[model samples]
Target: MSGTALLLVLAAAVCHASWNVVAHGVSRIGTPFLWWGAVASAVLWLPVVPFTGGLGGSVGGLALGAGVSAVLHVVYMVVLQRGYAAGSLSTVYATARGTGPAVSAVLAVLLLGERLSALAAIGIAVVVAGVVATGLVDRRPRQAPAPVDGAAAIADGAAAPASTGGASEEPAPRADAAPRRRRRLDPGIAWGLLTGLAIASYTIWDAHALRTWELSPVSFMVGVTAVEVLFYTATLGRRRRELLDVVRAHWPRVLAFGVLSPMSYILVLVAIQTTPVALVAPARETSVVMVAVFGALVLREGSVAKRLTASVVVLGGIALLAL
Candidate 1:
């Protein structure tokens, strides 16, 4: 990679993590939050669309690629929002981001018939291992409830029936039941996997689109951002109130994510013009580590040390892939 491309990728990494932090902070709004962000992004980049080909320059095959990319991005946004809802930002983000490159690598080998060096293979393994460790294994330290003495248990049992017919004791078991049910379905891992798949799909489509159209990065991004905004807006489906609520409550985030999301990728697109996509993709994922740290420190997600360790391993693998 050229020095300028290297710097652009690094900047993109930081900006990517920063907006994700913004989104994670208000993930409760779900798809609405995402939609607003896309709206903002579309507005901001709209001017560039006219200058950079107005969503259809030298049209023939570019339309399909751009359309597919827009559809993929909508799915990516939904999965990311849901992932934030179901899991900690660090684990979900790390797992989702980490899964992308590994899957992308496999696709390259199987579909594109790309060859990797031994070092890149090892790197892919490390990335997969780290993702499993971070995403699947519940490493959060559980606080064991203090053990009750036999005498106290008997005393409590004896006293319970006289008061409200053991109502308090009944609710304890019922309350405990919900958490057990929740534990059975770990949405974090599931959503992470889905997010990874979406990333891989878009990566492949974008690669093909670039090769076919050879359009400038600015034009392509502007068109895609506009389409993403339209897609998300159309899918509101009885959720318009919820979307309005997000806009009212978190306009700053709407603006921040709006600018950051598209601009960050614009940087990557520029880098791709100068460097190979193989180099740019892995280099951009360095944000995975940054997102983990942001989750632990700014968001106060648990198991910071363990998550960071896993993030380091994943980043090592990504760096190897880039090399």
Candidate 2:
């Protein structure tokens, strides 16, 4: 990455991380929050379309690319929201962000004919390894109690002070619940992986769209976001009341994210215009570390020290990719 591109990507990382934190805060609202944000993005960017010179090439081609990107973005939003609802902010965010660049790198190599340096390959592996390790550690089960021996249990009970009659007895733990708890799916991790795939699809698609159509980034974002809002509204028609509730409660945040999401991606798109997507993809994902930090400091979802360690490893990988 060149100096200017690196700076742009880093700035975009901060914006991306900040908005994701905002999104995770309202993850329970899920698609409602995203739909509103998309609406806000559309409204915010529409006025600037003309100023940005609008679509400068084939209108049909631009619309086609925008449509495809809009669909992929919708998938990304749904999956990311599911991830936030199901897991800790750090783990889910890390996994989703990590998966994007990794998949994007593969697609770029195979379909886009992009090449990577030896250091970049190693960096990508390190990033993938760190993400996998963090996910594994996040999913690790806590130690369950050891079985108590009858003699020991009886002795311990005999030595304990008698409870007062005024005190209410606590309910016994249910043995039957353990199986159900164990069987429950970690939707966050599952959705995080899916979100990565969606991101990779759009990343490659957007790159091709930009290269082929030469559309202004501003106009392209405006068109795609408008379509995404329409798509969300059509699909979520049944949950209009819930969507309204979210909008009434968090309109400010919705607006902020609406602006941040596109601005962040626009920066990445600009970087991609000048640099290889292989390099830009991983560099842009430096946001993984940024979001992990926010997840710890702002959300307090997990161990900050542990998440920071994992993030450092991810940054190391990004640095190598940059080299």
Best by TM-score: 2
Total clashing residue pairs per candidate? Answer: 0, 0
Candidate 2 Cα lDDT to native = 0.68
lDDT of 2 at 217: 81
Over the stretch 193-221, how does candidate 2's per-residue lDDT look in tens digits? 88778878889999888888887787788
What's the distance in Å from true for residue 38, model 2? 1.0
Model 1 TM-score on a 0 to 1 scale: 0.72
Q: Please report how far candidate 2 places residue 80 from its true position, in Å.
A: 5.3
**Candidate 2 runs further than 4 Å off:** 78-94, 133-137, 140-193, 242-244
**How well does candidate 2 score on lDDT at residue 318?**
70
RMSD each, Å: 11.7, 12.0
